[model samples]
Target: MYTELNSILNTTPDSFTQGEFILVSDRQSDASFLMHHFLSFYLRARCKVCFLGLVQSFSHYNAVGQRLGVSLVQAKEKGQLIFFEGLKESLSVLISQESNTKSQAIDFLRDPSVGLRSLYEFVRCTVSSSSGGGEKGADGAEEWGPPVLLVDDLSVLLSLGVTVGTVLDFSHYCRATVCSQLQGNMVMLTRCDGEEEADDGDDEGSERLHRGLTHQCSLTLHVQGLPTGYCRDIHGQVEVCWRRRQGDGQHTQKKLFQYKVHDKGASFFARGTSSAVL
Candidate 1:
């Protein structure tokens, strides 16, 4: 699916595993394009995906997928993709009467819950059901592989009034659940807001949250817009830094790339060449 990108990450087909947690940080404007590239890679690899789109509608994702020739609708129909409907859930309190009639509604508003519990439950159930009472292969191994869990933006929860500590706890719980219960991988996209004043406590708090999650992640990728002005033929310039966990500790690598946005889709390439590395 993404041979060069996987090579950059030092992943080999024989050595691939599902336990890693990847955290991608970028400015809000550039994050969407990068996320689409990342998700397309996994989806093309035939990995089942559970997507939690916090900042965008499912239709937006589907449109992007179509442009990229990923056929997200077909993936969903084949039970290879599951969307959690984060946009709908976030607005549920305001638009739906079902919540008002149930005790869940009161808890939803009063508590700082980011709705991770429900998502976790859903993933658990889906995995279990997919197993079909523990279907086995010839050698007594599981017939199916672990799924990939993708969360569009964690900062959306913070914007919705979820505390940093609560969000961290929820993230940790999700990581643990995926690794231990589902044997899957998790990829989370979050914004690194650089606009806040240096002395602002909220800014400090946001930085702390970003650092906290970066520390927990097995791989951390930082995307920054290039300083040069945009060109007619270029969508934008971006520098990507990848830090991966190694046996001894952590190792860092980086690359500079430019992207082009076309009417149908977008593509990224290493600087000065057509070779794509992201």
Candidate 2:
């Protein structure tokens, strides 16, 4: 089921295991495309997926899933897919004009603590519910597999005034909790050049967040966008690096690949190999 992705990782059957944090870094647009590939792979593999979308609307994701041949509606109906509407929640809070204190606009601009807390709570609830037979299953037994938690663009929280420390703590907590308790895999997407585009304080915060998450995560995937107008046939490049915590703590050699986006989905290949354009 995950043949394409497994081929990119050069892994044999039963070699790919869940229960670790995987970080995907890229430009905003490219990151979104790569995320679709990852999510489609897991969903097709019959793993439960909880998608927390902060960068794009739910409709955008639904369209992308459809193009990838993933039936998001069916997944949800089968109790294998759940979505946390981060964008919708933020927009609702920002546009609300009911009886409040000072100004609704100013309140929206303050901090993202409220939103962050809500997100954390939602994740906790979803994880807890999926553990037992809280949701229906195919057979009489509970459909319990290692769930995949995907968060699109963690930088959105930072842009909404979430402190670096808070974000780091939240990430660590989620990774530990999900990997240890639920025995699931957690994937987070972030911008590669965030530190370069922010102010001094934000720059430092972004750098710290990057370093901390890099150390905490078991695997990291870096996506580099091709030079503008340089390669019409290629979409982008990726590097997958991983380390084992149980062994000597040594890192594995990085694997490189290039991908092409098509109507169906993204296809990965060796860096220099030529794939027929779809």
Please tell me which predicted candidate would have the highest lDDT against the true structure.
Answer: 2
Could you estimate the TM-score for every candidate?
Answer: 0.77, 0.81
Residue-level lDDT of model 2, residues 1-278, one tens digit each, is: 23576676654333446687888877433667768877776786666688888788878888888887887877877778887666666665667645363223223234666434545666766776777664665576347466778989786667778777777877877886677788888889877554244546445455567667888888888877664534767878877888664665565757877777767766778867846543
Q: Taking the candidates one at a time, how many backbone clashes does each contain?
A: 0, 0
Query: In TM-score terms, which candidate is top?
Result: 2
Per-residue lDDT of candidate 1, residues 1-278 (tens digit): 34455665666544566688888777534666657765676677666677878788888988888776687787787676777776676566556667655324113334565454654566566555554534554555434456677888888777777777876877887787775567777888888776434436555355667788887887776665555654566666555555554754647665776666666555567775644322
* Candidate 2 least-lDDT 10 residues: 101-110
- Give candidate 2 regions above 4 Å deviation: 10-15, 27-29, 97-110, 113-115, 134-142, 194-202, 227-229, 245-250, 275-278
TM-score: model 2 vs. ground truth:
0.81
